[model samples]
Target: MKHTARPSLLLGIALLMCACSQQPDRPPKEAASPVVVAPAPQTPVDEVQRLLARAARSDPATANDLRLDAATELADRGDTVRARELLASIEGARLEGPQWVRHQVLLARIDIEDAAPATALARLDNPAMQTESAGITRATQVDLALVRADALQALNRPVESARERSLIQAWMSDEQQRRANARAILATLSQVDMGELGHEIGSATSDDWRGWLELASIWRDLRPGPNAQRAELQNWQQRNALIPSLEPAYRELAPEILERIKQPRRIALLLPLGGAAGAGAHAVLHGYLAEHYRQLQAGESAPPFAVIDTTSTEGGFPAAYNAAVSDGAELVIGPLLKEDLQAFAGNLELQVPTIALNFDNENPLALPKLYQFGLDAGDEVAQLAREADNRNLHRTLLLADASPRARRQVEDFNKQWRARNGVVLDTLYLGDLNDYRVQLERTLLVAQSRERSDMLARTLGFKFESEPRRRQDLDFAVLLADPVAARSVRPLLSFLYAGDLPLWATSESNAAVAGNRSDQDLEALRFIDMPWFSSAEATLRRSIQAAGYSGAIERLVALGVDASRLQSRVGLLTWLNEAGLGGATGELSLDTQGRIHRRGQWYVFADGTASPEKARPETPDPSSTEGGTAWQPQEQAPQTRDAPPRITP
Candidate 1:
């Protein structure tokens, strides 16, 4: 009975437990829904501002960093005032390493923007903020160095600026970065005076630095073509083998610096031997042959040469070129006419190098080894414009003949003069030498002055004894006239009461030979011509005459002689214009467009003869003098001569 009662109690207990467990499991409390709060969107400025506000509450150093970053952004956004205020709020004393550098660099940038280059330089001169510092990144160092270089440049310390730029290269590990820095330094050094630059290069403390500076200097001055540049680089390597630090830089530049130009073994001559340009072509040929013979007499080996006539009706230019090529000619020179040059423009599949004697009016297709050599009138006028600007002659009068050639000269002169900020007071085109008085009156506004004088006289009821004066605004006169017209026009200018005004003329204004009577009228006329024509050396004159070349053809003869000598050195001319080939024609340089430019000697008609003019002193800086009158004529012997007759083109 006790067991049965115990069992019933156990069952009752189990039932009670079941009832407690089954009493509807109260729904488990739902897990609290995650409070997903979406973050609010913010702009760059707002985010930076928030960062600044948070940093200020936590870390002072972090706050300063945020302030600097915000300042840079503000400055970039053209809010410089706010940028400066933010920058000023940063406690600079707490910054270190790259942060300190950033602080100083930002200040320097602001100073530079304010035109305080000296202040900018001072800020960047801290020794602690070094590029070699492990805490600073290479990119940051380069950027800092660039800003310093710019500050130096703005201060007119280009040498110092170049040195600063060189620092960037030293820190650069990337080849492209090094090359870009080197180019920047070279470009800066190019604008510095050669003498000053040489001094700066010589003063370098390290052999490596000196080597780099020298390389840059050579590159800046010579601007050598691929072949010439390779030669120069090779020469540099030979001389600078001791500079251990420069090897990597040089090796990296080898590909860009090394290219080869084929040496011509045989050459063919082309000329208009029987046409309007026949005389000029013959003179050139004679000169060329004379040079070749001269070289042979000097025990030098001469290249094999052949002649092809472009004027021959039997075979044209193409046939001549083909025949020359077939004969193993590696080079050809000729086609001394614009039409001939234009005709050959379409023939781009030239087998070998060919130099044309004339240039097409339009830009021609750039074929391999096709060059143009001619006495370009446009070059002369451009040079004249430079001379005028150098002398500070701001206002000029242009008097040219009515011919097409003269008109072209005037147009080129006008374009060049205006390019230099010069003012063209007036331009006069004269049809006849006899009409000089009328043209001068109109151009000089003398007739208008005279008319005013008559009106004044009528109003006053009396005529003044003094004649009406010419306009005083003209600082100089450029006369593009033939010798005949120049002879007549020069004296006419004096009679027109303009003798006191300075006059400049082109080579065409002077005669190769003139009588004393004609020379008397050409006194004070300054012109430019080839050295072969104006050389005072009696031996040179005798040699030229002995060669049977004179007058208008003398220049062409000189051109031919230069062409022959330059055959082997044409690559040099293409790159190094400042180091020109000292030719009989003049200092000759070949431009990138394949045109030869000759810088001629200046001369003045004196004592019934033309004499080489002494080089004038360097013109004073316009800002250094009152009224900017830097040009003053040197006293010259008074002489005159008749102008030579015009040559038909």
Candidate 2:
């Protein structure tokens, strides 16, 4: 396996690196345990050798600089032992200035890597090192702060770790790197409980440290309404105007943040109310109005919005959009169809910011002011691939109903899975539930087991019974079918012998929670669906049901609610990439393609109801490696040719 081979490759390079340089005739100070070196490519080992050879022929100062470079390379490769050896050699030469700062920082880094966080902290706290490092290059200062932060984090001191990163943000030359550092500081602070965070803010010693903690507190407080949250953020920014390092990021993000909470002057909704899509459009309208009213009840200003039925209007999409703009509409949120979106995409006179209700994944277009938001089922296949990869389920079998949409999903999942270097052991398209046994038997090689028994019987004096075995090379199965079809297939899989095998599905297979006993047929099925069905939104679901909306249309209502909320914050998500806005539909984010993606929650069917899947442990058992087929027999092979209805294919 590549995973096991990787460490050996890095260790071989470390051995090669040791041979290239002269080792001081002294033992390495013993570590509590071996440093768990990160695997690296072979390129850096060659570079380290060249630097050391150059150092051998240089003057004392130049040689020490070369040695420092060599040590940095080794450290990056996770060759901590050899890296420390090189640093020790340089320290013996009495290095000074920027070189001395780099040497001390690197020694502390090695100490941390060797699990000696206390020693690392002591070395970095050397008052003499700090005074000398002050006049060093800005880059070196950032490096020293980063080393100290790592030491603090290793010691479980998150508050001090965040403080060290906060202190060096202004010294970073690259704007992008500085932004990343700020994000890291917030991330570290997020680990501290709110109680501890509040206590630290009250007792903070440095102004900059206190300012960062305050900003983090404002962001983490989710109880406040949108307006209240924005007001607090603006107030905090005004109070910390003198904090130079935090100002640039705030300035860059302010426009988007303000836009997020600000309501448009006039809004328009374009829906096909008279066409075949009228029912679906009305469901979406219900959801949109629900959120609009919810926001008003929370003391936010309500902007008047006009609904233009594209089906009843002249010139369809163009007429509806022009009418909205002519009436001074500041934002438009509609044209809920692929053809309508194409009309907007082709119209050269489009100027107002618009959010299309659907995306044309095949023919994506990115105009300056156009954004796409929708509940795209195709996106779920991509998510499924990622989930499968995360579970180490590489060798997979796909089973789906024979439909064009199912075919597209299979193709899509295959593309994503193969990109992750996963192998597709088999794919079976189901035409009828009655034939699943035949299809699965063929795919899982169950028929081969039967034939082997037949052949053995032919050679022997008498026939004996043996259980038919399913192929064990598949790690898991992907079920792409509707609830009705899944219910049938799931039980059939158990009958065929794979009841214990893991099965995965997407929202399509998720059925209404009507407490029907038949729902028990989906036991053990793990699937991803919107948070709308999660218990956290029990009240919201009750409200929707009170309005006489349920089943498939409920998802559209949730989509409509998200569309309403996203209209004002699309700009925010666009500028701050990867920053997701929590929406009723899911965690809403925008991809570079100008299409909004939703990441939903995972649930498992149990006791005739779906519940949130249990969170996976931070560290999984190494013996239970993911990927490849290794099925441990759950029961001994039966003496008869029959096995419980099988899960072979």
lDDT of each: 0.63, 0.70
Q: Distance (Å) between predicted and true CA of 63, model 1?
A: 12
Encode model 1's per-residue lDDT on 346-420: one tens digit a residue. 663578777777776576645557778788777778878878876678999988877889998998998898888
TM-score of 2: 0.68
User: Candidate 1, which ten residues in sequence have the lowest lDDT sum?
Assistant: 1-10
TM-score for each candidate, following the candidate numbering: 0.60, 0.68
Residue 49 local lDDT, model 2: 77
* Residue-wise C-alpha lDDT for candidate 2, range 112-214, written one tens digit per residue: 8787766766666654453455456666667777777777766767787788787777777788777777776776775554446678899998777888888
Shift in Å, residue 70, candidate 1: 12
Local distance difference test, candidate 2: 0.70
